[model samples]
Target: MTPEFGSRRTAIVTGGAKRIGACFVRALAEDGWTLLIHCRESVAEAEAIAAEIGNGARVVAADLATVDGPDRVIAALEGMPPPALLVNSASLFELDSHDDFTAEAWDAHMNANARGPALLSRGFARAVPAGQGALIVNLLDAKLAQPNPDFYSYTISKMAFAGVSELMARVLAPQGIRVNAIAPSVTMVSGPQSRENFAKVHAMNALHRGVDVDDLVRALRFLVASPAITGQTIAVDGGQRFLSLPRDVQFMES
Candidate 1:
């Protein structure tokens, strides 16, 4: 069914063109929510996804790394109802070590992964009407809690987002807006990796398996639907958060 203009409840999903972000868009589409799917580059992919969903799913292209990007996204919705849900799923993941990390690299990661989400959430909060409720879900990494020095800049940026989630949750609660985060480990992305490597990462957790997209989708739905839950970070990491893997074990033993 097609949503009447400005009639259906809306959701803004950053980085919704691909990967886990696309999964969230699909799930919300199935639930009949109108969507504003935001992407940085992937224009063709974003358009294709909007066409596939077909319930008034519109694509907005914006580089979240820029200071004005989030405002651009909000401005694109001028005639429509403000979004009731905002999913901050767009992130940059780069491998950087302390020895090699540069100021430029750190800023790039922080701009996309941390500052972007905070600004987007701030915009979303401003759009919501008084006494009405809204939800914001920030995507995070399970390793933020564990502190992996391998992905130094990425980890630090995600940690910043985690803090953003909590601070926004408390600050916006009075406005009836709730903010929370989801941290997932070893989830498959749209990238190339050997099966052996994939299996090794999957087995790093206590459950000996990685958290799937479905697991994350369920957690997100729960957070959005649960009114009492706020300022919490749920790690859907198969118990990886509780135990640290041995440094020598890169892959599962044959």
Candidate 2:
């Protein structure tokens, strides 16, 4: 059934053209949210998603790494009713060990994961109307909790963004805007060794499992509607965060 525009809410979810972001968009679409889906390069996928959602849904292309990109996205919704929600789901995850990390790599990580969301949150608060109170959900990672030595820059960047989530929550609350986050452990995506990594990561979870995208979508919906909850980072990590491994143990021995 085509969603009713009048009853529909609207949300702008960055990096929402595919994967976990797409899952959230689908859930929100089903819940009657007309989406402003954002992507940096996935135009075809974004269009496909727009077609699928079909409830006055639209797509915007914005590079989170550029200053102009955030402004362009915010401008696209100008004079329209303020979106009821914003999901800063766009991010860059790259593996850079400390010794090999370049200035370019560090800037990319900080800009995409940390600065982009902060800029968007600033825009959302400044633009969204009061009494209508907007919700913002930033998709963080469980890697922030247990820093991966290999993925150094990505983990550090997310850790900074996670802190920004809390700051936004406290500062935005006075304006009736709620900001929160969901940190996921292992989201099954693909590559040659992806399945092996997925299995290893899934086993790290106390539940001995990995979560499907649907699980994250559920968490997003709850946070969106839950006015009382803000500034918190919920670990949708299948209890993986609680598993304390012995750091001193050598990987070769294990």
In lDDT terms, which candidate is top? 1
lDDT of 1: 0.82
Q: Write the per-residue lDDT of candidate 1 for residues 17-99, one digit (tens) a residue.
A: 99999999999888778889999999899999999998778889999989999999988777765578899999887766889
Q: Kindly list the per-residue Cα lDDT of model 2 for residues 176-231, writing each as its tens digit.
A: 78889999876765323355555555545678677778888889877866768888
- RMSD of model 1, in Å? 3.3
In model 2, the clashing pairs are none
TM-score, structure 2 vs. true = 0.90
Give all candidates' CA lDDT scores. 0.82, 0.78
Off by over 4 Å in 1: 1-7, 189-195, 246-254
Each candidate's clash count:
0, 0
Error of 1 at 177 (Å): 0.2
